[model samples]
Target: MKIRAAVLEKIGAAAPYAQSLPLRVQEVELDPPGPGEVLVRIRAAGLCHSDLSVINGSRPRPTPMVLGHESAGEVVEVANDVRDLRPGDRVVLVFVPSCGGCVPCAEGRPALCEPGAVSNTAGTLLSGERRLHIGETRLNHHTGVSCFAEYAVVSRRSCVKLEADISFAEAALFGCAVLTGVGAVINTARVQAGSTVAVLGLGGVGLNALLAAVASGAREIVAIDLNEDKLALARELGATMTVNASDEGAATAIRTATHGGVDYAFEMAGSIKAMELAYLITRRGGTTITAGLPSPEHKFSFSPVSLVGEERTLRGSYIGSSVPVRDIARYVDLYQRGKLPVNRLMGEQIGLADINAGFDRLATGHSLRDVVVF
Candidate 1:
């Protein structure tokens, strides 16, 4: 079948993506689901920074790739050996395609699945095969889910069936932002009720972290970001305080506001500076969790003595350390109960043609969660 998909032919073609237009919307042929894979009709896809990183050459991936990962769709067809899901089932695409037999999967850490990582790096499905072609040219998948297209063939492990009432846009958000942000708090950090929390970089993920902190009953929630608009939105969305990270006195202000420092500081802005600031604001024995993905070449340093003496813990949270099957359902239930208002994160509704412009806003930090509703 021929489907309209966003194909990135080159990386870093130039910025203000609207001007450079790196991702060309073109018609491509897609294959039917193979064994252990399912064909999905993508209903909605989110514009995540991870995709932008690839376009701008900040995060390197194989070129000529179909780039999209966070999405929600309906299963249109199921291949042989796939039994748990069927046609018409609502599903959210997971970036990591977990092989159930992997060591991490066996240990209930599907987010760290070994085969999934290898397959993602290879730009192939879990079966190590490509299912997309542009006439004679083969196209690589993005994180096992090239969901920017109208249809996607993905591994069974790449999807989580959703409840009937959840909207595609909301489900798509669950695929990345919610999972990474909320998961970082509840799973990685295990933030306690009445704990002090500070989240740096108020983008979609950071805001979701703030929401999770609020739901967890945190006494103090400080939102840090360079954007005043985002900081204002953070305050509206339950942040107890806000700080402009651009301010030189920002660190001191945060320390004073929290009476020294917060119990947990989450860095969601993919930057070494943000990580350093997050580390600085964490109280003694507190945890600093970073869910951001900076360029592989980027690195940050820490004081070894402070880490030892203060007992400060630093950890990286990928996909929020989530087991999607379990965590998505739990988070959705909370969303239904009016606890997690992830809907507030939605910024714009756009068609696939406006994708490049949407990306420009995303790259410029002008929009939160822009959705391509097919």
Candidate 2:
């Protein structure tokens, strides 16, 4: 079938993406769902930093790929082997498609499924196939979910059926931002009530972390960001205090305010500098968790003595160390109950034609969670 999708022809394009136009919205052919796969009509897709990383060449992937992972859609068709889901079911697309037989999947850590990682890195579906093409040219899939189009064909393992009543725009966030952010606090850190917490980088993911911290009953929640507008929003979203990352005394101020730093610090900005601050602001015996995906070439150095003496725990969380099938449903229940006010993160709703301009806004670090509404 013919579909309109955003294709990243190349990477490392100059910014002012509105002008450089890295992603070209063009017509492409999509194949039918294979066994264990489903065809979905994409209702909404969010522009996230993970996508931005590819555009900026910080997180390199195969190019000429359809560039979307965070999305929600209605099932239109299901392959024969996929008996659990049917047409008309609303679902959020997960970037990693776990094969149940993999070691990580068996250990309740589907996010690290060996086969999923291989397929994602190779730009293929769990079945190791490409279902998109332009005449004789085959395009790579973005983490097995090329969802920046009217339709997508994804492995059944890449979807979490949504039982909650919510708009597609709201459900789209659960796939990435909400899962990564909320899961970081609830799943990764296991933040206890009355514990102090700090979150670095108030983007969609970071702000969601703030919301989760509040829901978890954290005594003091500190929000840090370079953008003043974002800091203001953080304050509105239940943060006890907000700090500008650029301030010279930002670390000192946070340490002083929280009485020698917070019990848990999260780095969601996908920058080495943010990671540094997240570590610096963590108190003795505290934990620092980073879900940020900086360039693979980038490295962060720290003193082992601090880890030994302070008994500090530094961990890296991918997909918030989440089990998507279980966590997505739980998080959605929280959202519907008015505990996780994720709706406040919604920014501009745009059409596919304006995608380049939308990304330009994303690159500015000023936009909220912008979604492409079909």
Candidate 3:
């Protein structure tokens, strides 16, 4: 079938993406779902930083790929031998497609599924096949979910069913922002109630982390970002404090405000500078978790003595270190109970044709979670 999709032919294009137009919306061919896969009609998808990373050549991946990962859609078709899911079910697409038998899956860490990582790096589905084509040219999948298209064929493991009442836009946020941010707090950091916490960066993911930290009963939630508008929004979303990271003395200011340092500091900004600041603001023996995906070429350095002497912990979180099957439902339940309040993280809605402009807004920090509503 032919469907309209956003295709990124090259990377490292100049900014003002509306002018550069890194992603071209074009009609492309899609295959029916193969075994262990399903065909989904995308209803809504978010323009996330991970997608931007690919377009800017920061996080390198094979080119000529359909570049969406965070999306919600309805199942239109299912392949033979697939069970437990059928047509008409609402589903959110997860970037990682876990093979049940992989070591990480067996160890209850589907987010680290070895085969999923391999497939993502190779730009192939879990089965090592390409299902999208442009005339005679085969296109690569984006993290097993090339969902910028109107329709996508993805592995069954890439989707999780949603409740009937949840809007596609709301479900779409869960696929990435919510899962990664909230999971970073609850799963990766396991932040204790009444703990002092700090979240660096106020993008979609950072805002979600702020929301989750609040829900976790964090006593002092400090929100840091270079954007003042985002800082204001964070305050509205229940952040107890806000800081502008652009200040040269920002780390010193944060330490002073927290009365020494925070118990936990989370780095959501994919910048080495932000990671170093997060580390600096964490109290001795405190844990600092980073969910940022900086380029492989970039590396952050810190004093080795701090790790051994202070016994401080630094960790990286991918996909929030989530076990999607177990965590998505739990997080959704929190949303329904009025605890998570993820709805506040949503910004504006756009159509598919406005995608390049949407990306421009994201790059300029002019928007939060911009959903492409079908």
Candidate 4:
């Protein structure tokens, strides 16, 4: 079948992406769903930093790849072996496709499924196949979910069936931003009521963390970001206080205000500097969690003595250390009940043709969770 999709022909393009135009919206051929796979008519896809990382050459992946992972769609067809889902079912696409037999999957950590990681790194589906092509040229899949198109063929393991009543635009966020952000607080940190918390970066993921912190009953939730607009939004979203990362006294002010730092600090900006700041804002015996995906070449250094003396815990969360099949449903339930309030994080809705310009907004750190509606 022929489909219109945003294809990233190469990486490391000069910014002002509206001009460089790294992603080309062009027609491509999509194969039918294989066994254990499903064909989905993409209803909405969100532009996230993970996608921006690829465009800026920070997080490198196989190029000439369809460039979206956070998306929601309606099932159009299912492979024979996939009996659990059928056409017309609304679903959220998960970037990592877990093979149930893998070690991580068996341990209730599907996010780290060995096969899923391998396939994602290789830019293939769980079955190790490419279903996208342009004549004789085959294009790589983006984390087994090349969803920046009208349609996508993905492994069943890469999808979570949605039972909640919500728009595809709202549901698309659960696939990535909501999952990563909320999951970081609820699943990874398990933030307890009355505990002090701080979140850095305030992008889609960071703001979601702020919302989750509020839902979890945290006593003091501090929002930190370089963008003043995001800080203002954070204040409205129940943050007890907001700090500008660019402020010279940002760390000192947070430490003083929170009485020597927060119990938990999350780094969602995907930058080494954010990670360092998150670590600094964690009080003694507190934990600092980083879900940011900076360049693989980037490294962060810290004093081992601080870990031992302060009894500080530093952990890395991938997809919020989430079990998508379980967490996505639970988070959706929270959203419907007005607990998560993810809708407040939504930004502009755009068409596929304006994707390059959309990315420019993302690169500038001024956009919210912008969606491409089909």
Give lDDT tens digits, candidate 3, residues 262-306: 999999989898999999999999999999999999999999899
TM-score of 4: 0.99
- Supply candidate 1's per-residue lDDT for 72: 98
**Judged by lDDT against the true structure, how good is candidate 1?**
0.93
In angstroms, give how far residue 244 of model 1 lies from its true place.
0.3
lDDT of each: 0.93, 0.94, 0.92, 0.95
RMSD, model 2, all Cα superposed?
Answer: 0.7
User: Candidate 1, residues 267-311: lDDT per residue as tens digits?
Assistant: 999989999999989988888999999999998999899999999
What lDDT would candidate 4 get against the real structure? Answer: 0.95
lDDT of 4 by residue, 1-374 (tens): 99999999999999898899999999999999998999999999999999999988899999889999999999999999999999999999999999999889999999899999999999999999999999999999999998999999999999999998999999999999999999999999999999999999988999999999999999999999999999899999999999988888989999999999999999999988899999999999999999999999999999999999999999988998899999999999999998989999999999999999999999789999999999
TM-score of decoy 2: 0.99
Stretches of candidate 1 off by over 4 Å are none
Off by over 4 Å in 4: none
Clashing pairs for model 3 are none
The candidate that achieves the highest lDDT relative to the unseen native structure: 4
Measured against the true structure, the TM-scores of the candidates, in listed sequence, are: 0.99, 0.99, 0.99, 0.99
